[model samples]
Target: MTRTAILVGITMNQVNFDYSMEELANLAEANLIEPVGVITQKIDRTNKATYVGKGKVDEIKGLADYEDVDLVIFNDELSPSQIRNLEELLEIEVMDRTRLILDIFADRAKTREAQLQVQVARLKYELPRVVGQGEGMDQQSGKGGLKNRGAGETKLEMDRRRIKQQISQLNKELDSLVAERQVQRRNVRKMKSQLCPLLAIPMLESLRL
Candidate 1:
């Protein structure tokens, strides 16, 4: 099913700002996510907390609610704190161009090698963000409102550990596959070298005649 999303970006007077936003919409389409609305901020710099100014963040929140989007897609990659802050204010699933690209790569990965590479890239990308997510949760867990804070921390720890383990395993598999390919390539080269002398014998005889 096609999901709808709001496209968000901040333009710092860059020449390629328009092109980048257009590409983001195209990426959303490629991921089966329809671009229902677009929200852009023209600023000299990004908001360190939300990647957009407070006013622009509110605007995006309104648009997300109005469009009832499944997620909001940012034109650039957002920092983990920025993502957390934006999601908190917007109250919607947030995505960035980097994650969207990774999702597309994952969807198109057909071979085991390609899949392993994608998985590793994704895990690496997620590892830091997971820490960012845990930061806020861990802080809130001490408060009276969040009683199950310990459970949440435990789960986050498990997630972090699991991601690390998966990344390590995938890397090992990739290394093994790469080594196997290297050996195969060496064998092919050796065979070609052995056949070259035989090939040259016929050429030498023809030259003599």
Candidate 2:
């Protein structure tokens, strides 16, 4: 039999995140991810580097070990460095808020355009951190170029180059798609101009009330 692990979520929002966290754990369970624990940090704002506080992160790591958990998930977008740091410290698979939503969106994207849009958004979110990580690799590599590099190329340089190329390609594709969308939007505006209201439908409903 497979060993089960825990699901962890930390969110700064205190209002409606509780129900979402429970739902997420259920989804994880359905995927055979054992819900060992969840740690939430209800703060006014999310931390920039860690998302959660360092103190909270350490606490979660401890809980994971105590629970014998194999994974950790965050309820907010985490920088790439945040992922690297958490994975290094916890020795577990770590995923952020964006990744979870991206997984759900990818599965639900039926149209070719929808699929491409999701791909572009995911890559754009990832590219910055991939580039940022290369800075750390550069320091470790010292003066050496590709020879002292990691994997095939210098770790820092390679990730930067690859991410740059991918981002450029994705941008070109998105630009073409956006151009098509502009034409469609114009057509819709012309046809719906007579029926289009000045304000949002929700605001109109409130007025009716």
Candidate 3:
């Protein structure tokens, strides 16, 4: 069985943003998730909280339920609180702009370095507003025991710290690889320049220089 997804794109002009949204839908299809429906909105500016307006959210939610979709993919990045709210109301997986694109990137990151970078970025984005971490802060503050002490360090915090460390290490490795590529490029350029001078000598002779 295949999972179905829907692309919900909201833009000021349907003509202006339609192609990008369509491309995204294609990417979803390539990943084996069927993008069976689309919801477009012409808005002045995207809502900061919801990206799409509240009414549109409800509309999309209903569409997802009616379509029996596994996920609703938004075209813009959403706040952590917004994701939480939408998940609570929709009772389905909610993926925002960045996460959706990163998922696409991860799928095609055939190189080890590229794969590592994608994972680091994904975890960094996902660590915040994770379930139980943000919600338990207030509850933990009220408890008066050693177990509760430093309990404000939520699971998200632990994951965030671990992600940061991994990112740092990956950055160092990527940097080394980048430097190696630069040297390779330099070598190729040098060989091409040397060959060009030799080729020019024969051409100049052919012209009786």
Candidate 4:
């Protein structure tokens, strides 16, 4: 199913703002998202909290509500707080350009290595954004006993740990793959070195004659 989206951007002395927004729209379409509208603000700087001016955010919210857009995509990478704030205010899914590009790469990844690299990048991007949620993190529960280390860990904590572990594992795997390629390349060079002497023998004989 094609999801409708609205593209938003902030132009802060950017010479290629129009081209970047156009590329963002193309990216959305590539990810099976239909861009229904475009919104841009000419500002000296982005809002620290919302990544856009408050008034611009309000206008985006209204336009999104009216257009019934399923998602709003920003032309720049947004901080986790910005994403959280925008989603809260707009009541819709929000994605930044970095995430959109990653999604496209994920979808287009045909090889295992490509997929793993994408996963690694995504996990790294999400590592810092992981935060505790609701009563799950606050409530103290002792399923084993009273000696289970404080509140027995929250879902957010677990998520962060899991992502870190995955990132480490993926990095190791990527390194191993790269090492294997290097070894293969060395072997190929060795073979080429041996073949070069053999080929040179005939050329040298012809030159002597």
> Which model scores highest in TM-score?
4
Better of 1 and 2 by TM-score: 1
lDDT of 1 at 116: 95
Candidate 2, which segments miss by more than 4 Å at Cα? 1-5, 10-13, 26-34, 42-49, 53-55, 131-155, 174-209
Report lDDT (Cα) of residue 80, candidate 3: 89
Maximum-lDDT candidate: 4
Clashing pairs in 3: none
TM accuracy, model 2: 0.60
Best-to-worst ranking by TM-score: 4, 1, 3, 2
lDDT of 2 by residue, 93-198 (tens): 8876577677667767997678877887777777666644546444453556566544344556667677678768877887888899999999998868855664
Question: In candidate 4, which residue pairs clash?
Answer: none
In candidate 2, position 37 carries an lDDT of: 73
Q: Which residue pairs clash within candidate 1?
A: none
C-alpha local distance difference test of each model: 0.88, 0.71, 0.79, 0.89
Superposed model 3: Cα runs more than 4 Å off: 127-131, 134-152, 179-209
Poorest stretch of ten by lDDT in candidate 1: 136-145
| lDDT for each residue of candidate 1 in 1-209, tens digit (9 for 90 to 100) | 99999998888889999999999999999999999999887888777998888888889888899889999999999998899888889999999999999999999999889999999999999998885354445443355336655543544677788999999999999999999999999999999999999999999999999
Measured by TM-score, how close is model 1 to the native structure? 0.82
RMSD, candidate 2, Å: 10.4
lDDT of 2 at 46: 62
- Cα deviation in Å at residue 45, candidate 3? 3.8
